[model samples]
Target: MRKLGLGLAAAALCAAVPVMAQETAPAFDAEAATQAYMATLSGAARAKSDAYFEGGYWLILWGAVVSIVTNLIFLRLGWSARLSAWAGRRTQRPFLRSLLWAAPYILIISLMTLPWSWYQEYYREHQYGLSNQSFGAWFSEGTMGLAISIVVMSLLIGGLLALVRRYRENWWGIGAAATLVFVAILLMVAPVSIAPLFNKYSPMEAGPLREQILSMARANTVPADNVYVVDQSRQTTRISANVSGLGPTIRISLNDNLLNQGTPAEVRAVMGHELGHYVLNHSFSLLLGFGVIILLAYLSVAKLVPVLLRKWGGRWGVTEVTDPAAVPAAFIVLAVYFMLATPFTNSLTRMHEQEADVFGLAAARAPDGFAKVAMKLSTYRKIEPSTWEEIIFFDHPSGHTRVSTAMKWKAENIGAADIE
Candidate 1:
């Protein structure tokens, strides 16, 4: 979602794709292997994980519906019109007007969605033994997130409005470039500026693991001097590590969950996968991929909004894309687009993840480690989703795919003296 245009609306999920290699692979029994992994979970854990992941499928459907419906309601109630007129009356400056208009618009939408957010992020998490946060702490973070969203959306909207006013006939091209630049800047600043809002990041304690992580970063040309540990146990038990930022801001960070819950081999495997993201330049590739998606979304809006307005513009008191009041209706279109594009976008992410798996195997030389970590991930993710579900819903490899890849790697290189 951080990479997606709507910023917070998109769900960050995971999936799998098969990997190809020169070595003849072992014919691992995927179904039996998946069954073995599922057997590892307790009856309660299995039910809960199944319920949580499966419930997520429904959440996706409902989230899109809610987003479109919410925006439509705002337009129908004339809230967008009233807010736009108020901002117009108060500000003569274009940027200031856009900022003024965006503040309330974003706040209204956030407030409207608070109930769902609470249920999804807070209540459900606690119910599942995943959350370590108190309600107050969760609320505080949510508030901070909302504030940041307001500032970001305001700036982005101001720029977009200026572009639209300046190049009404062909703003899509210019708008796409600007959108790319904005996202680039956001990624650059995120590690240093934005990430600290919710969690404290301290240099990881001096130890072999830190040294190992730094070495991986060095080998990968990641430009990171230290491994930072984010205090994520304060919120959830999902284990993770990431190579975030780019260029001068490049940094490697791992969540506390990974340190506490993962074995040393699992740690290396996960770190390898994270490092693979940076080493393989998946971030920029993903940015470029999502950028294209965003471009198409913007172009679709540009092409369709005029026609839509012709049909219902008078009813909502909206004239065109230039009008600040048109934001809600435009949002409805974008949200629908986001929903429709999920499978395509998700496939792109899954492919990148599979490549990372291949790279992780080579980099960490910990095939068993990778396999165990993949099973561990099954604590939250459905390890054996149907093929179509995996294609449509996941952004990272499923456990069966990952474990099989690791098994194949082991089969090919079982007696290698040195993986390092």
Candidate 2:
């Protein structure tokens, strides 16, 4: 999610306190409004939309250019090696040889970025009124997170190096594509495995609301297996739910906070949106689109890395992918590549989100429910924006736009959408 207003909105997925009543504000019917808005696009808007849809050609160019520049700079500075050495030296005075062998380049990068997780969870989140976590809360979470990151990054780095060495000039591009596929697999399965490491989950106890939720699932053909509620309240207090997995593995999971904080209507609305994702097969489509992007990235990386590495590797006091210092340079390269591809990558994701919004309305059969769900998110989102702002920044429909959609649907279905 692009956090339509700010990155702060993402944390809204995790509630920090128990549910409380909110002062009634407004309705948000995203489905119909967005469809109407899409219909209203003209000239440049249509072209830009087409460009985004057809594949953001410019993003590919930017990804290659950024990746090249980042690698050149990182390798030149030998930053990764120094940072790894610095951490090892401070923590245990470990011998440079041992640290170099044991920690590896990727491990060092992960270590250095530890502060980011801290800052985001503790400081930035608090400032935004989204995180109520205490110091101890943040610390324990950070330690666990570090452990996970080290393991994941090490494997990614190791796999990438293996490719570079065996495949030579072709490795960079192939590796980039491989990374995209790897990430998609993680997205599908990780919530089941990785999320548990951070929180607890249990089946929703038997009850009317719970039954209604299940009934809705049954009514809509959503799989009943794996419907679970996670103890998300252990960390923060925000409402969330999701429809995850593919095929028989599919499941509907909700944050306990949603159960506690949200009204039944809100819960249904949220689930309806998630169900929309399920019916529309958002993940499958996204994965496919991402694969296409990966191919584009790989082609660019293959042509660019060797030429740049041969020219600049020695200057960075590193010549190989395994070099600790070179790892940071490579990370920087990858970051730039991913970042430059943002508009393009994000466009695909937004399209899927839009599709789900429409599907949610039809499946949930409750524009009002969807409307309220949007209201809950208003604090975390940019409620309204100029047309250009939406095209550029919104990966999800804007709150106002979402509400309008719901209203439009109500108008067509019932002849009047009285709620604002």
Candidate 3:
């Protein structure tokens, strides 16, 4: 009887062991965890980030002003008319004439805006310690970008002018459709062709990390066989990755900065987020949404341009909307329209980013890793901002928002086997 009782007691204790372990586990406090992550970026680091990001708000306004002013200058001085007249002299075909006009117009505007571009892209980036290139290197890249722009813009202008001349009444709708198609083509081609012109891409070295990423891609149904790494460190220290292109052109690429600075888990977190963009079809969705917006912009331009041309066409030497010389005036209208649409566009992108964040949390199951990457990004992005500020200015969730989201996920997923 004594031995039987002892054995029974032992069994009872064993049964209670698992329950006790469960009861003893501490509850995960999401808000506390988020606050702890926020605390990581404090003092000068926080201030510097805030300053850099806030300065960008001013830059946005100033950039719009500069663009509008530059276009206006072209109109006011009749430079656009002169270019159009020169192109007409060179070619009888309206399409070819439009292309000729666009090439020089682009070049001249680029030159006109070079001082501001230097300040905005080069000087400002260096001032914030975000750039790694010297002035010569920066200018070299700028020249490449300019050449690409001239070619692309010239073709677009030619096509737009042809549409305008052919369909004066409904040109806006047709032009909008053509622009969207052109944008889609650019998206498809840029990942393979244009991106390589800026950075060298090579297969990620054979290793467990590469294998792990490939496995993740497979699990997510991402059609990728290999990972590519870009030499982005030569340009900037920003850690970035992308799953870009459409259909056959799709490429999964991470910059060397990410490889050098991130832990395996952090890399996975970032890649998972990028993969979410692909899996969710964000590229197509974004293009579609922007297509609607572009269509609206075209409608507005269509209505307004004719009225303005009738009033000022004589002075500007622009006879009608179909005139290539009217391009700057059209651009002026577009610049204003886009400037006003900034908040809507930002919100659209921010919502997609938020959705990607949620997907990343689920896929990576590395909330802490995600939080840490958010902290790193705070080096350039303001970690915390006023609610309205975020809504108005941010195109991605603020760092605080990202970290809090990660912590919230962690809280719900406490003790999960795969969570780290």
Return the TM-score for each candidate structure. Answer: 0.90, 0.72, 0.93
State the lDDT at 118 in candidate 1: 96
Q: After superposition, how far is residue 20 of candidate 2 from its true place, in Å?
A: 48
Give candidate 2 regions above 4 Å deviation. 1-104, 246-248, 320-325, 415-420
| lDDT of candidates 1 onward, in order | 0.82, 0.62, 0.88
Clashes of each: 7, 19, 0
Write one digit per residue (lDDT tens) for candidate 1, span 1-420.
212322222221211322232122333444455456556775877677778888888888788888988888888888888888899899888778888999999999999989999998999888887888999999999999999999999898889888889999588888988999998999999988999877899987888987887787788776656468999888888988777787678777889998998877788888888888877888799999988998898898888778878888898888867888887777888888988998989899999999999998988888778888888787788777899999998888887788878877765565578552
User: Poorest 10 consecutive residues of model 2 by lDDT?
Assistant: 17-26
- After superposition on all CA atoms, how large is the RMSD of candidate 2? 13.9
Which one wins by TM-score: 2 or 3? Answer: 3
Return whichever of 1 and 3 wins on TM-score.
Answer: 3
> Which candidate order results from sorting by TM-score in descending order?
3, 1, 2
RMSD of 3: 5.2
Best TM-score among the predictions, by candidate number: 3
lDDT of 2 by residue, 18-50 (tens): 223111211334464555444544465445434
- Candidate 3 local lDDT, residue 212: 81
Q: Whose lDDT is greatest here? A: 3
